[model samples]
Target chain A: MTDEQRRRRGRPRSEQAHDAVLAAARELLAEVGYARLTIEGVAARAGVGKTTIYRWWSSKAELVAEILYRPISIEEIPESGSPRDDLAANIRLIVEPFTDPWYGPALTGARNDLNADPEGQKAFQAQIMSGRRDTGRAVFQRLVDAGDLPPDTDVDYLIDVMSGLLVYRGAIWRQPITEEDVRKLVALLVDGRPPRRTPS
Target chain B: MTDEQRRRRGRPRSEQAHDAVLAAARELLAEVGYARLTIEGVAARAGVGKTTIYRWWSSKAELVAEILYRPISIEEIPESGSPRDDLAANIRLIVEPFTDPWYGPALTGARNDLNADPEGQKAFQAQIMSGRRDTGRAVFQRLVDAGDLPPDTDVDYLIDVMSGLLVYRGAIWRQPITEEDVRKLVALLVDGRPPRRTPS
Candidate 1:
C-alpha cells in the first residue's frame, strides 16, 4: 500500500533468503546443538551463500540470537485496565518462549554453550538480557505514570524480582508454572501480607 | 566424649585424611575448574591414595558435592520469632555459598559443568535443592502455624519466589546484594498494597 511496497524490487528476494537462513539455522541447532553448529552448515542447508548470512549478522551468535527472537520483542507487554492483569499477561508472554518444550530446550542449549564464549556471552547479555530489562522497565514506568503503581516504587528491583521468580521456576526447577502461581506473584507484588501484631 | 568418639583409633586417621582430601578438592576447584579437575589430581594434592578418595565417594561429581555441602543445610532457616527477620536470614544463608568470591564461583562452575552429567544433576537436586525446599518448608510451616501467614498460603511457590529472586540477582547479574534488598523483598512478601475499591 505504501510507496516502498510498490517500488520494492530486491526486498522479496532478501526476505525469502532471510527466512531460508533462519529455518536452516533452527533445524541445524536443534539437530547438532549450538557448539557444533557452523555458518557454513547453515548456509549450505539453507541453500544460501555464507555472505548472505554475514550481510545481516556479524557472528554466529548474533545470527542465532536473531533467528531465535520473535519479530515482536518482550517490549510489547500486554495491557489491560488493571495493573494485575497487565503484569500477569506480561509474565506469560515473556516466559512462553523459554518454556516451550521443543524451541525452549534448543535455545537453552545454545545459551548454556555460550557460557565459555566471551563473544556469545557479551551478545547475549547486551542483546537479550538488556533488551528484556529495558522493555520491562518501560512497561513498569507506564504503569507508574498511570497511577497503577506507587510513585515511590523501585521499578528496577521490581522487574528483577518478577523475572527472577519466573526464571527460577521455569529454568531451574523445570517445573510447569501454574496460572495460580502467576496470579499470586503479581498479587504479592501489589499487596504484601502484613504480619499480625498483638491484639489492640 | 561419647563412646564412639573415644574408642576409634582408625576413625581419627580417616577423619584427618577426609579433611585433607576435602580441603584439597576445594582448593583445586577454585584454582582450575570443574571440567579440568579429576579425582587423581585431588588425591595427589591431598597426599592420599586414590583408594582413600574412592572409599567414601563413587565419582568426582559426588566427591565435589560432598566436599561443598556443609552439615547445616539451607532448609534449616533461622528463626527470630518474626517472619521478616527469619526470611532475611534465610536469604543470606542460602545465598552465601553462591556469592562468596572464592568458594562460590568454583561451586557454581561445578554446577554448570553438571549440565553434561546426569548423575550430578540428580545428586544436586536430591541432596541440595530438595533439602532447601524441605528446610524452608519446615520454617514456613512454623510461621503459618503461628498465624504469621495465612493458613491457605502456598508455601512451595512462596519459597521458589524468594529463592528465585535472590538467585537471579546474585548468580545471573553478579551484583552486590545489599541488606536493604533482602529486607525489602521480605517486606513485600509480608505486606501487600490494599486493593483499590470503588466509591459507593
Candidate 2:
C-alpha cells in the first residue's frame, strides 16, 4: 500500500456513520438547499466532526454525488414484454421519485446546484449520461431487437425524447406526473397518431 | 380615475429607465444568478438609485419576473401552417434563446432560485400557469381548430409534454438544444413512431 493508504489504518470506516452523514446531507439539502448547505452543518447534523466528513469526502459536491449514487440496477428497468409497458414503468419510476414530498425537494435542490457548479455539473453529466444513459439505451435496444421499432429509428433520440419529457414535468412544470400522463405520452409517441382536431 | 391614480402623475415613469433597469437585471442575473442578485446591484449596474428600482418593482423576484416578460410576446409562438412546423418553431424560439451564453446561465440561476424560494415558486406558477399557459393553450387551440390534431387529443397534456422535454434538456441535461433536435422531438411525439430497442 502507498504511504497515504497505510496511514489510513483504523476500524476501516463506520458504515453507520457514513449512512448518518448521507441522511443528514439529504435532510439539510432538502431544508436549506445546496447553495446554503455547508460541511459544518452536515458534520453537526450527523453528530460527527468536520474531519470525519472530510476524511470520507473531500468536498460537499463529492458527498452529495455519493448520496445520489443510489445504484439504479438493471432490474429496475422492467421488461414487461411490451415496449409500451416498459416505457410507462420507466417513466413512472423516474417521475414518482421526484414527486415524493420528502426526497423530491432534496433531489431538485441538488440538481440545481449541479447545474450551477462546474464540478457538480461534470459529476452529474458523468452519472446521468454515462451511467443512466447506458441503462436507458439498453432498454431501447431491446425493443428494437424485438422488431417493435423501425430499423431506421434513432435510439439515442428516442431515449432523449422520453426522458426529456419526464425531466420537463418534474423540473419545469413542477407538477405531479400521473400514470395516466405516462400512458398518454407513450401512446402518442409509440402509436404515432395524427394530430387531433379541436372540439367546437 | 381614482384619486391615487390621478395623483400618480410626476414626470411620468421613464420607459427608458424601466428598460435600462430590466437590461441590467438580466445582465446580472446571467452573471451572478438570482440568489446573489440584489436591488442595490441592479441599481448600481443600471446607474439608478435603489429607490428608483423599488419604485417600479417591489423585489428582485418582481424585477426578474418583469425581465422575463419581454420574451413572452405573441410573435414568439409560431403559426407555420402545419402543427408540426408551428410546434417546432415555437419550441425553437423558447429553447434557442436559452442557449445564448448570457440567457442560459441567467435562466438556470433564476430557475434554481424559483424552485428553492416559496414565494418565487408561487410567482413562477402564476406567470407560467396563468399567463404563459394561456398563450400556449391558445396556440394549440388554434392548431386543433385547423384539424391538425385529433379531436380527442389533450392539448394541456401536449403542452406539458413539450415543455417538459425542453425543461429537461435545458435544466437537467444542460445539453445544447438544436433546431434539428426540436424537429426530431416533434416527429417522435406527433408522428407516432414505435419505440426503438434498448441498447446493450
Candidate 3:
C-alpha cells in the first residue's frame, strides 16, 4: 500500500469511539452524577485508553460540560400566524427537555457541580444566561415587530419574567413543564387581569 | 462538689469542640468540595473521636443536610403591608446567607453532594419545593383574602410564576437578587399589560 493509503486506513480514531465516550459520560452523569463520574470509568466504558480520553478533555467536568452543551436554537420559531402558538412553541422547546428524566438528572447534577466550584459556576452562568436572554429577546422582538406588543414595552424586563419563570419551575420546583402550564404563562403575560393597587 | 453541680459545670460536652468540627467541615467543603469531604478530617480538626459525630449523624450527607436545613420564619419576612415589600424581604432573607462568603461555599458543596446521591437529591427537592410553595401560597392567600387579587385568580399558578422567577434568577442566572428586581417581579405579576393577540 502507498504511504498515503496506509496513513488513511486501519483503525481510524473511530467516530464510534467518540460517541461511545460521550454516551457513557452522559449515562454515568445521570446515574452517579457529576461528582462521581471519573475519567477512568468513562475510558473503560468507551473501550478506549485513559490517554485517549485525556487527549480530548482536560477533566471530567470539562468533558461533561461539552457533552451537555446542546445548543437550543430559537431561530426556528414557528410563524403559525398566531402569537399565542408562537409563544407556546418557544416555551415548549425550552422547557420540555428540562423535565425529561435523563436531562433532569444530568442538569441537576451539573448545577450541583457548578455551584460547588466558583469558576465552574461562572462558566455555566455565562453559557446558559446569554442563550436564554437572546431567545427571549428574539420572541419579544418578533411580537413588537408584528405590532402584537407595545413598541415602548420593556422587552428586557419582559424576557426576564418569561425566562425566569421557566428556570424557576425547572430548577427549583422540579415540576414537569406541561403544555397547559406553558399556555397559562403565555395567557398571563399577554392578557391577564388588571393590576392591583399597592397598599400604602 | 455535688453530682448536680458537677453536671452543670465544665462547659457541658465542649461547645468549642462542636464549633471546631463544623468550622473544619465548612472549610474543607470549600477547598475540596463535598465529594471529597471525609469524617476523618473533621474529627482530626475538632480533636474529638469520629464516634462523637457518628453518634449524632449517620453520614456526612446527613450532617451537611442537617447543617443546611433552615426554616424560614414569619419574623424573617418584614411586614411592609405591600406585596412588593414582602416579596423583597423574602428574597433577601433567602439570598443573603446563601451568598455569604463562608456559608455559601459549604452550602454549594452540600448541594453538589446531594445532587450526586438520589436519596439526597429527593430530600433536597422536598425541602426547597415545599418551602417555596408554602411561602408563596401564604403570601398569595393573604393578598387575595385582602381583596388585592381577583377572587377567581389561580393562586397556585401565580405562585409558580413568582417563585419560579426568583428561583431562576438565583439558581440559573446566578445573579444577585436585589430589592429592585423583586419589586419589578411583584409589579409585573400584579399589574403588567396583558399579552397582545396573535393574528388568526
Candidate 4:
C-alpha cells in the first residue's frame, strides 16, 4: 500500500476497533447481564486485546454506563402548555427508561458495580452526568422562559434534588414513581407547596 | 443427658448459633467487604453449618443489610425546640451512619447485591424499611404536634422523598448532604419555600 494510504489506515482502524468493542460489550451485557459480563469476555468477543478495552473504559461498570447514558434530547420533552405537566413528563421521560424490564435490573446492577470503582464513577460523572445535566438545564430553562418557574430558581440544586429523587426511587427502591409522587415532588420543589391531602 | 436437659439445650444452642452467625457476618464484612463476603465464609467463621446460615438469611445481601440496619432510637434524636432543626438532625442521624468510611462502600455494595435477590429485597423492605418508616413517622408526628409541620402533611410521602434524597446523595452520589442542603430540603418540604440564592 502507498504511504498515504497506510497513514490513513490507522485512524479508521482504531475507530473500527472502538465501535467493535462497544458493540461487543453491549451484546454481551444483554446476553449475560452485568454481573456475569467481564472485560476479558468483551476483549475476546471484540477481537481486541484486553488493554484496548481497558484503555478506553476502566471497568465493566463504566463500559455499561456509557452504553446506558443515552440522554433524552430536547425534542423528546413534550411542549404542553402547563409547565408542571411538562416538568413531570420530562422527569418520567428521563427516568422511565430505567424502569424497562430489560434496562431496570441492568442499570441498577451496573450502578452498584460503579460504587466499587471510584475512578470509573468519576469518569461517569464527568462525561455522562454532565451531559445529562445539560439536558436538564435546557428543560428547566424553557420553564423559566415561559414564566413557569420563578426567575431566581436554583436550577443546579433543583437538578440535583430531582436526580436524587429519580435514582433513589426508580433504581434503588426498584419501584415506579407514581403520578401522584411526581406531582407531589414537582409541586413541593418547584411550586413550593406542602404536600396536601387529596380529598377522597 | 436427661431428656429435660437435652430439650432445653436445643433452644439455647439455636440462639447461640444465631448470635454467632450475625457476629461473624459483621466481622467478615469489615474485613472482606460486601463483594467478597460469602455465606460460606460467615458459616465457617461462626462455626455453624452453611445450612444454618442459609436457614436464617437467604443471601449475603440480607445478612449485610441486617448488620447495617441499626436504627437510631427516638432518644438519639436531639430535643431542639425548633421542629426544623429537629427534623434536619433526625435526617442526619438516620443517614450519616451509612456515610461511615467502613459502612459506605459496603452498604452501597450490598444494596446493589440486593437488587439481584428479590426475595431478600422484599424481606429488607418488609422488615428494615418498614421499621425505618415508623421512626420517620414518629419524628414527623412530633413536628406536627409541636405546631411546626402542618397537621395535614403526608408524613409517608415526606419520608419517601427524604429517603430518596439521602440515598441518592449519600450512597449514590457519594457526597455529604451539606447543612445548607438540609436546610433547603426542610424549608422546602415543610415550610413551602423556593430555594433562595445563598448570599455570595
Q: Fraction of the real A/B interface contacts present in each candidate? A: 0.44, 0.56, 0.39, 0.58
TM-score of chain A considered alone, across all candidate predictions: 0.72, 0.71, 0.68, 0.71
TM-score of each: 0.79, 0.78, 0.69, 0.76
Candidate 1 on B1-200: residue-level lDDT in tens?
78876776546788989989988988888788665789999999999999999896767867777655544454465567776677777777766666555444444445545555667678767876777777777777776777767777777777877777887787655677777777677666655542221211
Best by lDDT: 4
Pairs in steric clash, model 1: A191-B192, A191-B193, A192-B191, A192-B192, A193-B190, A193-B191, B75-B135
TM-score of 3: 0.69
Compute DockQ for each candidate against the true complex: 0.35, 0.40, 0.25, 0.45
Best by TM-score: 1
Please give the range of 10 consecutive residues that has the lowest summed lDDT in model 4 chain B.
B191-200
Extract clashing residue pairs from model 3.
A190-B194, A190-B195, A191-B195
Give a tens-digit lDDT track for model 4, residues B1-200: 99987876777778989889988988887797778888999999999999998898888888888878765566776567777777888887766666666577777677777777778889888987787777788888888898777778878777777877777677666678777878877877787776666531
Cα lDDT for residue B102, candidate 4: 54
Off by over 4 Å in 2: A1-20, A27-58, A65-69, A102-104, A193-200, B1-14, B29-36, B65-71, B76-78, B194-200
Which docking band does candidate 3 fall into?
acceptable
**What is the C-alpha lDDT profile of model 3 across B1-200, one tens digit per residue?**
98877766766576656666777776776676566779998888778889987775556876665555445665566556876567666666656544544444455555555655667567655665567567766766666767767766677777667656655565455567666566666665666553222211
Q: Report the Cα lDDT for residue B58, model 2.
A: 57
lDDT of 3 by residue, A1-200 (tens): 99877876654566667778888887777677655689999998888999988776655765776665544557767577777678788777777656545554555556555555667666644675567667767776777778877776666666666777776676444677766677667766765543222211
lDDT of 4 by residue, A65-93 (tens): 88776656667776787767768877887
The candidate with the higher TM-score, 1 or 4, is: 1
Interface RMSD of 3: 6.4
lDDT of 1 by residue, A2-45 (tens): 88777665468889899899889888877876667899999999
Error of 3 at A21 (Å): 6.2
Which model, 1 or 2, shows the larger lDDT?
1
Best of the two (2, 4) by DockQ: 4
